[model samples]
Target: MVRRARPVLSSLGPVTLDRTGVEPLHRQLYRALRQAVIEGRLRPGERLPPTRALADEWGLSRNTVVTAYDTLLAEGYITGKVGAGSFVASALPDAPPQGGPGRGDARRGVGLSRRGVALAAVGGDMRDPSGRPFALGTPDLNAFPFAVWAQLLARSWRVAGRGLAVDPDPLGHPPLRAAIAGYLRAVRAVRCEADQVVIVSGAQQGLSLVAQLLLDPGDSVWVENPGWPGNRAALLGAGARLVPVPLDHEGIDVEEGVRRGGDARLALVTPSHQFPLGVTMSLRRRLQLLDWAAARDAWIVEDDYDSEFRYAGPPLAALQGLDGAGRVLYVGSFSKALFPALRLGYVVVPPDLVGAVRAARRHFDGGTSIVPQAALHRFMADGHFAAHLRAMRALYADKRAGFLRTLDRCFAGLGRAEAGEAGLHALVHLPEDRPDRTLSALAKRVGLTVPALSDYYTASERRAAGEEPVGNGLMLGFAAHEAEALDRAARELADLAAAMA
Candidate 1:
């Protein structure tokens, strides 16, 4: 019986390169390394020397070693892990196949592209959280005038008959575009025409399209440090190198963004009501961001995700309203205003970018469904959208007040609430001794859905860069719940905190 080869501890014996040979150094190194692996001299699971160390020891350039290592990694002869350096493939080609179902396991031997791996790492819990206590980003579906919406949808289907089945314009349904354009101009103060509005499935899809259209691989992008995690996956999948800019009372710290990635090709922000934290960008900061974008010849994606639910003075004009240089791509969604299943949103691009965005949209799902577009257009054109917003604003205002009162009564010393003037949710900053994740798990046990604020922020990345971490807190959502539900949930959470103490 033949014996299996033993794995080497380190070093690939003594690899010699013929400097005078016609073969390129990287290719020669790759060949020699491949032959060693094939002959079992560098057996499976053996660690490869660091490229820099290998280069120094072998008298070769670091790039040559990297290229050789990369070739081995790409061909599956070796594996590279983040922070863990390269290692020889554990399942070498010569290994006997495992038996039965174990050999056919879907999790085994599944090789993903770099982008796929990145997307895989971006974890999200997409289960419907409607009616769940403290659920984030969900609207009060019970308050929606569904009878009216259903009527509008039925009318849309009847009017759009055969047309609804046909391929839609990549830009959008023309009338829906016109409706969205008018609504934005009147409400958000955004300056745009119907021709500039491109319909998408949702805000996430809008950001994804923006990333694909505006960003190239390795391009620097300024993202809010404790920003929306949903956008991170999209931006990263598009190959953007994210520069997490810190936030202040004025919103995204423009000066800090400049310091971190002054030459960033794009900036993604939630200027209206910053998510998770809900700090409105001051006018001065908004101007600074616009100026920076314009000066750098960069683009800004303004995500007005849930600004319509503001319980304060007057509604803040969108950042896009302040842009004169045509640098801002305004993205809005109906999910927060209407419902998640609607899956509809729109982007108002600069005139110059309209064609490109449309082209990109054509290839990305062939534009949103025409029937929903028509229904939403009817809903908005007939003033139902305005009425709905007004009702939701009042309902959410009361809910927020009651929830704050409950938090004050129940969680006096345990947590402090940042009751921002806007947003459907509030951030309750937990004491340093009480980590948000521990509290979050406790809340989960009692059927509450509060999430840790640190999950939204790249805490590890910030720590690695020697920056102060964003504060620990729980994001308690109130919009979707009745006041009684929110109050009960908050009291239960406070009980857990008290017990924890």
Candidate 2:
């Protein structure tokens, strides 16, 4: 393993850099040295400390010390002669600009790049305050088998050998891929081979990778009106014009989506269970979407997030299973099942796209780390994964029941809970007059965050023309907390609704 070199920072210098701070240590040291030189604190012609000496004195890496000195030399702030140490340059290159771009107040803050600006404008703002009770879109982390996981992780690392040294397969760890392929076949009834599964950091990364691989600029993409925010943001970032397809009781309206997005090249759908408003896609609807994608030469990115924890009804096969033409790209994540921090996800593509996706992954994502992949493989191989899933399903079933009951007791008829028999969250529809955005903010003030359903609707003009009112609801998550905590959160939501009403 390559360990980061330590820094040898001292209080004696004009500037002290925090090792843990987000700013790079080299950048911080460079700024400090530059400022000190410009202010004449370090006299002209004075020799700076040797890189070795400074590194030893401040517990910093010699390279960090050298880089800082090198930057100063390159910028004319310092000079060096062969066999002589570096010294502050007697004559500087140019005077600091008095009034240039980002002068005065602008200079006080760091500016973001164009890409950074765009991402920030549409980024998610999730908070896990107050021990993360009822936190949406997160698994029940407290129930994870950390001890068993640690054992598996240690074993994988010890036996790593070549895996630790060699460049990883961009597709994934082989055994882990095999494990996932087996699980998908036996459990989800998805048709895939181990070689076709491409492991990723998470479904979010998988979504972005799929877009990068397939989408073109200005290409139309069909998205659910009130859909997964991550997918919507990613599609927008990929330069796809998002046409919001409204949802019906069966799932995303396939006919409506195609009617609106006739020229669309891609579609993102959560078919097993719709997000926010939980509803399984009917077979006819699935087939219709499949037909549309196959006929139009478009790709369907099937996000089967949290498909393992079904609490009621018959099991539903993955949309990819029924996809005969290989148009569906199935994506899933361990974030919702295992834990968010695990950051493990997989994408099962068609046989034809496997090599293309795998070859592209080396250049783009470069696959996920091998350690976690190996550990997860062992976790599944040992039957711990299945056992964990069973326990979590029961736990969430109770949490969901308790949550709905509390809502019934506290604020009956005020909000409607829309949830399928599975998944981590449920959507509570608020009255039309209520600003779901404001209600979400009010809930967050007390450390309980419920996402506003309206924020998921991107097509303003289309929604206005629709017969049904624009989506106004609270996307409540019940899987993360215990019964007591869920009840408390429900009471809080009720109180907020009453007060706001």
Candidate 3:
């Protein structure tokens, strides 16, 4: 047998070893050394002390130190050579400076651009509350045909040829676009051809695309006061100045929008069932908005989200249907109808504006994934989409009725439901003296997320528009949760409110 030469081991810098419960000694050593590398305690290319020396110093087994060093080596925190021991990586991954002078300032967003800062200012602490009781803008996932969707998804790949293998259309899958156009025309009465329907990731993306493609910096755009906060972010990020137009029993106050920004470049409205308030836009206002866009050489963006769940008769005709001037760009999402994770929505643009929107969307994300687009087309083509909507409409109608009854029983004389004839949520207006914001926070502590109505408004906008804010109320969603769960949550919420009151 050949005689083996023992490799020389060099001494490393001193480090404290943690022998705390549950955590392995090797992992403890790994964390300390990795932190040292990250914090520049161990400078780049500095050789680490030999594992045996560290093991001996810290009363740890030699194997523990070796394992720790091995982990560091794997994570690129250190490098090892046959005889040279380990050295700190010459080039390390970016990590925030920690526990040193000026470290706090470095992480305080001091270097953000003006737009970045502006975007940050407009941001809210909005968290995903899917499957949570009374969570808005989400559908009943338990009722969705997920198994059917899975089958369709599998079929999209299994039975398909090169169509599924290649990149999707910059606009969308042609069949899906045509299907959307046909569906919109038949159901929502939106006027468009297959070419005019562009599939976007979601309605929010469609709004952002419209903002970037149409409006210029400082261009005034009409936005509803207490409207969707997301619309504000998208438009503001695109450098458009927002003119907050108030809403009434009718949809967006058309005359008021013109007063605020008559020459506005665009008007974004949730006309079909105005979000939160859930009011359907009067036909007169729809006509007035369309005429305003026509006369002022402007455009209108109609967000028709969640219209399919209308509790009354067939959902009202889309505001886009009345736009004879082809001035309306209709945005709708399937998140409320199907599920949020699908991330599927469509924009029906004017026939003339189709090319520009498609070009802009091409650069935004090339296009939404072809797999879902193809699957959705098949879903629509086979009539499953309509059938699902029918079932959900009936189910939600029952839930809506049960929810209203529960609210009446729980919040009698204390609050009244102000939601319109349709949509997933009820706007319960509390006595003005009962602060909804305080109540909303209190509800959150108990695992509830009832949104305060006042949080939706821009106070200055409400003041400037000479309109009183929607005032102390909570938007309680009823679609995602079953009637029993919603009733329980509503009763719990009422108890909390009564205690505070």
Candidate 4:
């Protein structure tokens, strides 16, 4: 009689035996299965060997194989059906689409476009918040001196009868402008008169005003690649064609800026702490950019977003400070340093552009709120603002150190963390095989949230479309958490990373 042929076992890839026994059998099985799924050796909806069969083949108990399968399911490596056993999860690569379906045509019949903007597309989600959530650009509210600010507000309001009754200047309150000018001189080394300062709502408003002042439709505006998405959106919304200049360890490639010559009229830069990458623009590059601007007669919008939190050494002077020619429009915001809701920031315009900016401001919001301006003026004049920065600098430094230490212990040799010298967040680069969405999804499962670095890019085509792109990483914010809480959060993140790996 012919014997029954043995059932063909599904190949979950080769599992190695650890004679040292440091690695657990279940972990080895899980890793092998995970690799198979991730590497596409195990196709989506393809059935795997039954737990009993796998266990028998591998010389392990049924419980061991079952445990491995359960782990894979929990981590989203594979899916298990009631009667059909287990199969690999669907794998969709995240890369820029190669001329796929048109967005307008695909949703033509549907009225979904009338709804609010997609949060994922714009990088602003309702779920973004402070308190150990890894939300980028959020300041530490607990560290802000509310008591001192209250006193300043009360004092400003007490004198409000005269300050509020009078019609405020279209260029913002004079005292506040003077205070800002003084602070910029002392801190940023920017030489600006009070009249040159135009107080706007925030950096976004400043950007809008700059766009209105400079851009004619179809004008070219050079923005940093893998930079701030909000700025790119604002520029595009104003109808200017965006030219993304690639960034390196030194900062934006100045030579590329010269090479992509067009009717390029503006170049926006975050020189102090280059946004997501966190590298400061070298003095040579800063001078080169300024010279380029001067040669082209183009405007440079220098966003000094979080320059005040530099911990390693003395803060670098603002690029506006070094502007011998009147080309750099320096923008500063109290939002990152103070609070987001304050809606207070000032733009130091070139003397030539001040009148136009003021005219644009009048047509826009008719100038910022009077009460907050008065209170902020009082805050600046009373030295409380400096004190606040001093306190926050120390606090943020400790938190930054804690985060770096924890990440070092966790990721170790797996990958490197870039731009930890300054700013609220650091850009952690992952392996080419890892996708940021996977990290984000895994992080969410463990109650942590991280902003994907790719979200900052200007062009959607820059990132892989369907499957999560390989150049995956996170922009981790440290400003919002206390040192102790940050340490705890880091440990939790490390544990998650190990499990995912």
Candidate 5:
């Protein structure tokens, strides 16, 4: 019988093994232990040292070591039984097979690229609430007009009994597509025919369809640096070489975009209200980007994710409306304005790309739920959609104002909060001395749910010109909170920041 080696505790960096620093001893130990486990330095099923022995060795309190072990157990990095101490988690079934890449030497003819190998190495982690009373993207379910929607849904079922059971059009239900087209033209100023509209499950599906149609492996795709992480992930997952274009106050730097060279085949932009940063792209840059797309024969993916709630100014014209050269694919969703779980959004493909996107949609999921599509069509055609948007805009605007007021009252002395102008979230740039991750960690300790802008950056782009590290700011979602709740949440967040300071 062979004996397994005991797991060795590895240090992430030199630690004083004392609890005197800003970070608690338990947290420092937890991070160090977690890093070792993730790096595979601690093999699966290996037993860890007893907490008391570890504490004695590290000159720390037994409670501190126990807390670190508890954290590891909670995170599934280690397992514990009543009588037994914790051990490294059993080898994950999905973990790479032993002997690594050469294990598949018999299939050497089945060539996979370096990027594929790299992507395969990535693993998933469970998402947990930050535990702070901070505002997140989840909407106040009470505010959703579920009763009216239910009525509409019932009416839809009544009107389309047997038809509802049939497969929907690949482009979406005809009535729904027409309704969406009309709504976009009326509200967003987007000129699109029903034929161009394809109903997708959500913005994510739309992105996937666009990626399928426009992206080829190794194609350079420009995405805003401090933008939507999901967009970056989707583009990269589609095998495009992501170019992180820096963002300015007016949104993505158009000139920097121009300098990135015009050869990049696609640019995914959220022009109405840029995510994380929450800056609107200026009209001048919008035109310039369109021209650049036309000149380079590149495609523009205009993700109008949450443009309906313009608290300060009139909503800007969607870039799709200005796409005379048909280089833009316009995407919009009911998720933000109405509700996220609706799982309905549409993409207006350029005439040439319509066939490809339609074919892709057919293979992807065929179409969105016909019942929801019909109900949405009814909602829009009957003016209910416009009414709902007006109510939500007003509610979100008040919530935004309340959030700002709370920041002004509680955090004014700490630092200035960026007036997001129009979006679910605002970016609060903390003092340069206060790292965003530190703030986020502190906020999480206090049960807040704010996301740092640094979390949105692509792994490769996170390093500076010389590969030095950089920090990003926090994203505070206000739309999810009621005016009163937003104020309370902001105040709580302010207190957390003040404590950190």
Candidate 6:
């Protein structure tokens, strides 16, 4: 074979080219030169050696060097003189000198608003990670047919084409919305057309959207006392003052909410299965709430979270379905069913408010991913979702039974299973004196997750009055874990509680 041409030596800054690298030779050269210029390693207006000479030095073709030089010139990294070699552009790219904030301008960490600071405080740390056994609010992800979901997702890309790839409707994918409407009608008795359902990232986003549209700054919004932290934060972020109403066994005490904030513009209540406490709103209570809302010209935000896997009697009818006055804005999430990462949920709004809700969604989040929406449409159409829910209900029922049995075996007093063993978690009552915080901390130390019920309440002092929060209890999750695993963990938790006692 003929010997390779010897490289002509040229004076330039160090640029060791790796021939074995996956990056193109021209790109590597371009990057090296760019870095040198940006870092000021190459002084401004410094002339570069002829490409022909540099090419030989780097063991690359003359064309490769020419391409790099051309790119640099085109991108303003360097200038080319017809008769002369490439020169580093006089004005180079570099940050302002380090000193004051603007002098070293960073994109972030600069003059954050009060809202930003408040949001920043909202939590990065999780109470339990690695899907801690008996953790509340977590679904049994193993039960979800992820492989089937993946196939459907891939199929959506192939079949749906460019539309699926582009920015979808801020409201939602029409097909998915239609499917959701039908599902709601058949199962939850929530009557609504496809247009009435605005797809959101989750229940949280749905709540936020409602808050943004309906709630003005300083507007009052009633929420459950021992309610979800996300709901509280979302309302607070929207500048809505919370009216923390006490909950009875009949769910949110409407009279108490009225007494606290009767003039409140909005009421965010979880009627089907109250969070932390797990009380289903009585029919009378539901009517009372509806009447109160209608009388005050106030809106009710019905968060129907975790009504799917109810181990008790038939699933309770959604407040939205029963609503004759169109006062309730119904919210539900798939996090408890499919998985939290999916981040797909919907808010069924009345006909009048749909446009405003959709507009708010556009400003908040342009739209949810079309691929998942399409996949969900397919999942619902194929009966896989229903089948999965059926299987999970049975599985969760057994797990709930195991947890209750553990409570009976290991603990003294009777611990009531909320809504007669509905949802993913159960409420185990502790003595009034046993500080729930101490119990929660002690449980956490043993690698067990038992969320204190009283912690859900927001007040100056510890306790809530009038059978509210129903007092000291542990909100133990039972659905995420398998029956045997839950049994072991619950027993171990009981042992920890006993030892502490």
User: Per-residue CA lDDT of candidate 1, range 1-501, in tens?
Assistant: 322222222445655666776657888788778768866888888888889887876677999999888666644577766788988877553222211123333553356566656565554542236467888878889889899999998999987778888998998899999999988898889999999999999998999998998899989999998888789889988998889898999999999999989999999999888887888899999999999999999999999988888888878899999999999999999998999889999899999998888788777778888888999999999999999899889888988888888888888988898678888888888887787766775565456777878767764645746666767888888888777777778888888777756
Models sorted by lDDT, best on top: 1, 3, 2, 6, 4, 5
lDDT values of the candidates? 0.81, 0.77, 0.79, 0.75, 0.73, 0.76
What tens digits encode model 6's per-residue C-alpha lDDT throughout 1-501? 222333232333556666766657788778777767767777788888888777766667999998788666644567665678778878752222111223222443567554444444332222354677757677878778999999999998889878887788999999999999999998899979999998888888888888888888889888888778778878878877777888888988888888878999999998888887778899999999999888888999999988898877878789988888999999999988899889999999999998787677778779887788999999999999999999999888877777777777767552444435478777778775565655665565456777777657764233423443346778777767776777777678777666544
- Scored by lDDT, model 1 comes in at 0.81
What is every candidate's alpha-carbon RMSD to the true fold? 11.9, 17.2, 15.9, 10.7, 7.9, 20.3
Candidate 6 or 1, higher TM-score: 1
Q: What clash pairs does model 6 have?
A: none
Angstrom error of the Cα, residue 78, model 2: value is 50
lDDT for each residue of candidate 3 in 1-501, tens digit (9 for 90 to 100)? 222122222322454444555557787678778777776778888888888886776667999988788666644577766788888888773222222223223544656654454455563633345467787877788899888999999998888847778877888899999999999999988888999998999998988888898889889988887777777888888888888888898979998877777889999898888866787888888888888889998988999888888876788888888878888899999888888889999988888887887778777789888899888989999999999999999998888888899999999978997567778889889996677866775566567877778767764544546666665799888888877899889899999779766
TM-score of model 3 (CA atoms): 0.77
Candidate 6 residue spans exceeding 4 A from truth: 1-127, 413-419, 461-470
Q: Which scores higher on TM-score, 2 or 3?
A: 3
**Candidate 1 Cα deviation (angstroms), residue 48:** 35
Off by over 4 Å in 5: 1-32, 37-132, 459-462, 465-471
Superposed Cα RMSD, model 5: 7.9
Q: After superposition, how far is residue 373 of candidate 2 from its true place, in Å?
A: 0.7
Candidate topping lDDT: 1
Show the colliding residue pairs in model 2: 6-60, 7-59, 7-60, 8-58, 8-59, 8-60, 9-58
Error of 1 at 371 (Å): 0.8
Expressed as tens digits, the lDDT of each residue in 1-501 for candidate 2 is 222434333322545667877656776677777767776777688888888997777677989888788667645677766678988778663323111223222532357443333344453543353455556777777899999999998998899856655778999999999999999998889999999899999898888888877898678899876777678768766777778888988999987887888779998898888876778889999999999989999899999988887878545799999999999999999987888889899999888888788778888857788888889999999999999988988888887777777766776867877678788877778896666766675565567767778866665555556854577888877776778887877888888787766
* Residue 458 lDDT (model 4): 50
